[model samples]
Target: MLEDKKDGWKAAIALAPAMIFLVVFMFFPLVNTTIMSFMEGFQFRANAGIFAISHRYQGIGFQEYINVLRDPIFLTALKNTMVMVVISVPISVILGLLVSVCLNNIKRLQNIFQTIFFLPYVTNTIALGMVFKVMFSTNNGLINLIVETFGGDKIAWLTDATTKGYWSALFVITCYTVWSGLAFKILVFLSGLQSIDKQYYEAARIDGASRARVFWKITVPLLSPMIAYITITSFIGAFKAYESVIAVFGRGSYIFGPAGDTNMWITVVGYVYKLLPSLMTPGNLSKASAGSVILLLIILAFTGIQLYVSKKRVHY
Candidate 1:
């Protein structure tokens, strides 16, 4: 009993630093944001003596939430984010799985191929974005160069001149999101594939199972756990997408394709980021906090649904 108790104390001591860090950075901020979200007629004042800004609400109600939901920019962000989630997640997962399987089958240069596919993940997002920007540049970009070589007109992919509403810019953004995320997903699936016992594959092959049948029955079922995990994380990440848009369209106002509203491609987190610089406006902090809270709830709800559904489908 004494030894066990002493070991328990040591374990607690080992975990203390992480627990404290989480409380200070994650837990406290979440709690504070939740409180701020409810503030109505919120006021912010700076006290030089304390070197801190103080804030309070005159009447706490649903005003912050109401304001966020009523904003057209927020609505547009919500739409783009939803489209991103719906489109990007599955495509990334499927492509990653396919590439992983192909890489696993190759007997030669497999490590080199795996590294090539994973290079984007290890590279900086801003750098990759710049490379992609050059590739898609309107005047002399690689994409335009190819198009012109084939007698097609040059198209401005990121600017407001694109005639396809938000589709052109959105296409560029979605492709980046999918391509950038592929490396991690491919790595995960490859790890899962390697962990599976060879006996299963051998048995399937001896039984003369077709490639399609073997894949769906053995590989897919074995990988369902990884797939579920990736899907959940991808959905959450897609909802919080901000930097990719910034990377592709830049900080320029009215750059979201044909509609040309700066807010057109603004994501939920992007909206929150834009509002955070202004502390002088009444309830401004509350509005940003409310937006953050809504995004949290959206992520939680989607995660919950995925978890529930995965219980039925996920093999492990």
Candidate 2:
């Protein structure tokens, strides 16, 4: 009993730093944000001491939440984010799995191939987004040059939002998201594939199973746990997508149409960012907090659903 108690105390001491860090950075901020979300009237005032400022809060309720839900820009942002998540997650997962399988099958230069595929995952996202932006630029872009070489017109891929609406921006963002996201998924899947027992493959081959049949019957079921993990994480990452848009479009940029500004390709994170500055005025703090809470709930709900489904379907 004494030894066990001593070990328990040591474990608690070892975990203290991490627990403290979480409380300070994560738990406290979440609690503060939730409290702020219910507040309505907020005012900043200078204290008697110079360089000292204080805030006053009033009216605790759900009005801020209502305002955020009703805001057209927030609604559009939600729709665009959902569209991005729906499109990018599956495509990225599929591409990652295929690439992993290919890499796993190849014995020669496998490390080089794995490193090359994973470079994008390690590279800075903003830099990758900027690189993509230049590649998809309206004039003299590599893609456009190829198109023109084939006697096709150059496309205003990013700027032509005036005619194409959200799609123009969506295409570029989705492509970048999938490309940048592929490396990690591939790495995970490749690891999972390697860990799978080769005896299963041998058995399938002895049974004269086709490559497709082996993959579906042996590979996929074995990989389902990794697949479930990747799917949940990718979905969450897609929902929080923000930097790619900032790197592609200027800050606070909106999608345009012939009629004028049509929509913003801003994700939920982007919407939260847009509202953050207004918090200084003590007016939109609640709104911003409410938006953050909404995003949190959304992520939680989606994660819950994924976990529930994975329970039913994941082989492991």
Candidate 3:
């Protein structure tokens, strides 16, 4: 009994550091942020040119939520986030699945191709965003240079919303997102593909099943579990896809747009960044906190719906 107690304590001691780290770096900060969202204004502010501190909780009503909903910027951010979720998730998953299957069929250089596909995932986002910004620049960008070299006019990739140039920027952003996101999905699909019984495919082939028919009838159903996982994760990732965009695009001038032409393309994280600066100001702090809470709830609702739907669809 004493030995068992000592072993348990040793195990707990092994876990203690991680537990402490989580509490300090994650849980405590999360709790503080949540509580801060409920409180009014900043923790410290200047009143009549004198420094002051207020700890009072405020803005606890429908009005807080109404205020958030009423803001056009917030609405645009929400719409943009949803659009990103819609666009990026499907494309990335499909592309990842395709790449995974292709890799599965390849006998040699499989690792090389898979590594190439995954390279972008490990590359620094800030560096990649900077590189992409230059490549997609309106003038003298490599993309425009290529187009012009082929006797095409030098097209504006950014800062021109007219004639769908704004969409060009969006496409550029989405392309990189898809590129960066594919690695994880590919890994997932590969794992799923590997786990599937080889005898199943052999059995289908002996039954005169074509490749497409076999894939649809055999591979896809078995891949559902990983597909479901990718779906949920991709949905969540859409909310976070703004990091690269923000790095490439300047802050808040075009702030998710080519001058109000393409409104509401910002992700939820971008919206939070918009409010983050208000943390130092007591007046705006509460409202910002409210915004934070709303964003959290929105994300929670989206993920919950996805999980419930996927659970219903997943066949054991």
Candidate 4:
């Protein structure tokens, strides 16, 4: 018992630094944010290199959450984020699976192909967004040039607000998101595919299984765990998309409609970012915190659902 106690003490000592870091950084912030979410009109005061809530406007209620849910801008951001998550995640997963399967089959120059595909994953997101913006520019973009070469009129790929009454910007953003997210999914799927038993494929081949059947029956079921993981993570990432919007459309840029009214291509994170400045005052701090809490809950709920579904569907 004394030896076990000594070992336990050593283990605790070893973990002390990491535990302190998490408490100071992650846990504290999460707790503070949750507390702020329930508060209204709370102000922050800085003192001696630390910040504390001022008691001037302490309101403990759900009004902030109600306001967040009712605010049109927040609602729009929620809709856009949902649309992005729904559209981009499935497309990315499908493309990743297909490409990974192809890559798995190609033995010659496999490393080179893997490197080329993974380049996007390592590339700077802002730089890639800039490149995409340039390519989709309405005035002198490569896409417009190609269209002009084919005797077609220039199309406003990024700047278009309403084609008939729908937000065209959503489509552009969705496409960009799917393209950007492909590399990571492909890498994970390829790794999972390689780890799968080759004997399964051999058995399928001996049974005269067609390529499609073999993939559906053997590869997909075996790859279900990776698929579930990728899907959950991709969905969360898509829901929090903000950088691409900032890169393609400058910060605070808006999509102008035919009636001259404007709509910002803001995601949930973007909405929170916009609201963060208001936290300096007693006006919107609680509201911003409420939005953040909503976002956190959404991510948690989705993750839980994915986990539950995976338990039923995933094989090992």
Q: lDDT: which candidate is best?
A: 1
Root-mean-square deviation of Cα positions for candidate 2 versus the true structure, in angstroms: 3.4
Q: Write the per-residue lDDT of candidate 1 for residues 99-200, one digit (tens) a residue.
A: 999999999999999999999989998788888878887888999899999999988787654346377788888899999999999999999999999999
Q: What clash pairs does model 3 have?
A: 37-289, 41-282, 41-286, 42-282, 80-264
Candidate 2 on 96-142: residue-level lDDT in tens?
Answer: 99999999999999999999999998898778877887888879778
Question: Candidate 2: minimum summed lDDT over ten consecutive residues — where?
Answer: 251-260
Q: How close is candidate 2 to the true structure, as a TM-score?
A: 0.91
Which lDDT tens digits does candidate 3 get at residues 225-299? 899999888887787666756755644423765665544356556666666654343245545666767777877
Arranged by TM-score, best first: 1, 2, 4, 3
lDDT per residue, candidate 4, 139-182, as tens digits?
99998899899999888776655553235566667667877888
Q: Which stretches of candidate 2 lie over 4 Å from their true place?
A: 43-55, 163-165, 250-263, 278-283
Error of 4 at 24 (Å): 2.3
Clashing pairs in 1: none
What is candidate 4's TM-score against the reference? Answer: 0.90
Q: What is candidate 1's local distance difference test score?
A: 0.84
What is candidate 1's TM-score against the reference?
A: 0.92
